[model samples]
Target: MAGRIIQVYGLWVWVAFAFFIFVLFNQSHSPLPHSSGKPSTVKERMMRAEKAWETSVTLRHEMANKHPGYPRIPLFPAQTLEAFGKYPYTIWDFFPPVYTCPHDIQRVGRLGDGGKWVCGMSLYENRPALPASKAGKRTKPGTVIYSFGVNGDSSFEAEMLARVPSAEIFAYDYTVASLGPQIAGPDSSRAYFKQVQLDRMDVLDRTPPFMSLQTLMKNNSHTYIDILKIDIEGAEYYSFDSFMDWCDRENAGEMPIGQIMIELHLTDDENLNFNRLLKWWERLEKFGMRPTWLEVNLLAVTLNPNKADPRCVEYVLVNHKDRKNIMRQES
Candidate 1:
């Protein structure tokens, strides 16, 4: 009887140890979405961000230093463990704090697959920062957006342009044969679409109309950008480097871009390309940026069918120190 009791106690201890390990692993590695406000503590995010970066590098490490990082947190208190186990799409049950801002994360369409969200930013920086004017073709201050990728699902761009009527968006996508913006709303004039690669120029165009971010800004007579969103398949990683190089050469220091929303694409062959992404995130940090929001694309699972893939995550970053630069530069 004594031996049997001891055996049972040992088994219980092992089970407890295993459960603890499981929790630790998920919190450390689970790619979680972000809510509003800043992360609670700095040290916590420093650790969480690093660990999170290791396994899956779909992140935007821009100007998120204000709030500490939240790791693969069991954010939803509403859903019980039993509820999560019972459903397939119950992954949304791990709810993070919902952010309300300049405009809420409005879903434009569920067209092909995945949810489309845009015009959504942190309320802290959601004011009408973009200067508007009564005079026609005003030159002093302007709000411009540069979108890099456009498949059929550019509803995110169209919706955002509609929300802020004063802002103009320049979208780039070499894959699309169409050369003009296809916005179907009142603010259609503010949006322009181009069939060019955001990453390359020499091959696509004769003069390369919209070759680089620097050239695009110069051509448009702008020094600072209000918002930049990139989803150019796998080229975002390279274009980001080119953009940084341009900033370093032109501005003498960091380029003041207000916000960035990028979708990172990892090759099916390579899971976590750490060294490259590590350096990329580090460069963004130098420019006073941090990751504000991150969400996984559950819709992507149906497309690829690879359970271990980490390609369809959208990351939002805030550039905290850009307003001054925009005000100081010649536009």
Candidate 2:
């Protein structure tokens, strides 16, 4: 969920955060293992939450002035543990993918083994190929990064192409004409661009309207994609099942994609409701994908909690096989 944890209150590690929260609030944290401290008094909890709220504000100011490029989204007071047992909707945004994992996600930012199993907007998950010139001829990146919303911002794709010359990228969005540098120039990397819309299901056509993941993969002849990154408005749900089905049919045991970093649009579609989407998410563990990072959509949710549930959330899910090497557990 590279869409996750960056100083989410110095959220680099749970041990550091557990110590920070416990020393400040004294409430048990369900996110980490060592946070089994007895729940604090309601008054004490409120005080702690208020302090956290203030810290978040200051952090925001600091990031805005200093590192404008790496912006961090804030969490709402309602979404925090401020009202833990006293409220119902308090947790509408409480989904920590690393802990509850198969169910929901919690905090955001780079959280993984700090090595291979990590997710979030962390660095170097897809390192550049050696000897850039020869690496470009490989025809594909070691990991395939699919960026959806090309809302005139493509620094992520551009950066990855510079680093990982061997990896190929397919950036989509009907709005943009092309993603970054053109694909044919002598200086062009392996990044490719598409203007098609993504949906749950579709058939190949001359028009190439809303296409499915199945069709996308087949058209590219890609049997497997190392990482699937998506941010296509609220259409994430439409193609998730199809992606899994393709994995089921192709690999028989392991899902083809090793990791998925996507911004989920938690829309209230009747057929693909939130609860139903969660059920499908839980099923992912069976295929070896497990949640590792969570970050709420500040623009859609935190900035306006009173409006409605946010449609955008970012998450990073890694495969089961990477647990030992990639999934880092705190000591």
Number of the predicted model whose TM-score against the real structure is largest? 1
Q: Kindly report which residue stretches of model 2 are placed more than 4 angstroms away from their true locations once superposed.
A: 1-94, 99-136, 139-141, 180-187, 206-208, 272-274, 302-306, 322-331
lDDT (tens digit, per residue) of candidate 1 on 49-112: 4444332322232211211332222222225576455322221212121221222334443454
Q: Which candidate leads the pack in lDDT?
A: 1
List candidate 1 stretches off by more than 4 Å: 1-141, 179-182, 200-210, 268-272, 325-331
Global lDDT scores for all candidate models? 0.57, 0.55
Give the range where candidate 1 is weakest over 10 consecutive residues by summed lDDT. 93-102
All candidates: TM-score: 0.58, 0.58
| Structure candidate 1, residue pairs in collision | 38-67, 39-67, 39-68, 62-289, 62-290, 63-289, 63-290, 64-290
- The residue-by-residue lDDT of candidate 2 on 149-258, one tens digit each, is 66665555554555455457777776677864323443255677778878777744635478887678778777666667777767676577777676677656566665
